[model samples]
Target: MITSSPPFFVPMNVGHAVVTGGSIEIVGRLAGQWFLRANFTSQLARDAATSLDVIYVPRRQANLELSYEWAPGSAMTGIVTYVGDRFADAANTSLVPGYLLVGLNATWALGEGYSFQAGINNVFDVTYQESLGFPEPGRTVFMAVTKTF
Candidate 1:
């Protein structure tokens, strides 16, 4: 005779979750040709079933930018970004460290609906991982020309 037992595991949504957060931003022109923009965010996320922090939800983040207008229709800008640590799994057992990145870019208008832009990302080539076993990109450079009608 053969006998079968019940399933060992079942997947179902048994509860609900709640999330709350707030963010603030500021943008303004500084002395001379300089400009400033900045923002920050903070949040709390929890899983109802386990009463634990939500997976992959960053609790804090921020960005700041400073720019200078050197010539007519031309500007150079520097950027800084930050991300807070977060969990990679629903159980909150795996943690991914936060990271910061810096970048710089320039834009020049060529007149008559034409423009040129270039930038580099991850200026210091900092190594980071947003998830387990997956690595983020290193220093990257990009350029572009756009024509608007």
Candidate 2:
């Protein structure tokens, strides 16, 4: 009778989970703009002790995005994140600490149908954990361009 959790786990033991998120955007004149966004979660681990339960984790916990285009050919965008830890540790793999990530993005219309966008993530590149025993990527830059059809 090798029972996991001694048949007594949490009221709801959500197993390892992975959440995906992203956004789409369009810039117009007069501080006009459009955007599309979405996010989702991975799977849940129902069996731990009996299984590996090494994929336990939690959701981002918190997220935020802000933008301002008060001048012509210029725009500024900002984002914040609070990621929850998702590691392997039986009972609840989602027992990692949370963290905050601040970012700022700017864009300038270089020409018609052509614009330049530059941004920074974790500008501080603060070290954090991506997993239980692994470190997440450090602060990085995000740049891009657009040309409508």
Candidate 3:
């Protein structure tokens, strides 16, 4: 008989789960008012019983952002994210592919107590799923205004 630990943590369940991972993060100024930030992570989670890859845990992930501050009260930012392929089930039979996403946003201070912001997400409208049987939203745009008393 073959058995393995749960691929993911369960509520009210007690057991030993072993996972090894590492991450890298960077933040720096690019040029003038331009700045950049990035992060990357790699991990391996396995089921002790069968030594199978854990479910819902990607092996690698990354994020990057670039921004520019122009003038006194205005700025623009761009972002990118990536997730590597991994198993969807403890058996490791179900595989999820890696994906990349991009976004852009702008912000402006309108006055003493008001501000405006707008952004677009998933600029390429790439189809992908963060979980099994669930589809993430396609390209989307949003705007917001804030005021302080």
Candidate whose TM-score is highest: 1
Error of 2 at 84 (Å): 2.1
Per-prediction TM-score to the true structure, in the order listed = 0.85, 0.54, 0.84
Question: Per-candidate RMSD vs. true structure?
Answer: 7.5, 8.9, 4.3
Model 3 segments beyond 4 Å from truth? 1-14, 147-149
Location of the lowest summed lDDT over 10 successive residues in candidate 2? 1-10
Residues 1-149, model 3: lDDT tens digits? 12224454242221444689999999998899998999999998776656777676788999999999886668899999999997766568877788999999998989997889999999999899987567899999999999978
In model 1, where is the ten-residue run with the lowest total lDDT? 1-10
- Error (Å) of candidate 3 at residue 16 is 2.3
With candidate 2 superimposed using the best TM-score fit, by how many Å does residue 37's alpha carbon deviate from the native? 9.8
- Across 49-111, the per-residue lDDT of candidate 2 in tens digits comes to 345333444533455566666556677877766666654445443455667778888988877
Error of 2 at 148 (Å): 3.4
Distance from true location, Cα of 77 in model 3, Å: 0.9
Error of 2 at 133 (Å): 2.6
Residue-level lDDT tens digits of model 1 in 25-53: 99999899999999999987887666777
Question: Which candidate has the top score in lDDT?
Answer: 1
Off by over 4 Å in 1: 1-15
TM-score for predicted model 2 compared with the true structure? 0.54
Best-to-worst order by TM-score is 1, 3, 2
Order of all candidates by lDDT, from best down to worst?
1, 3, 2
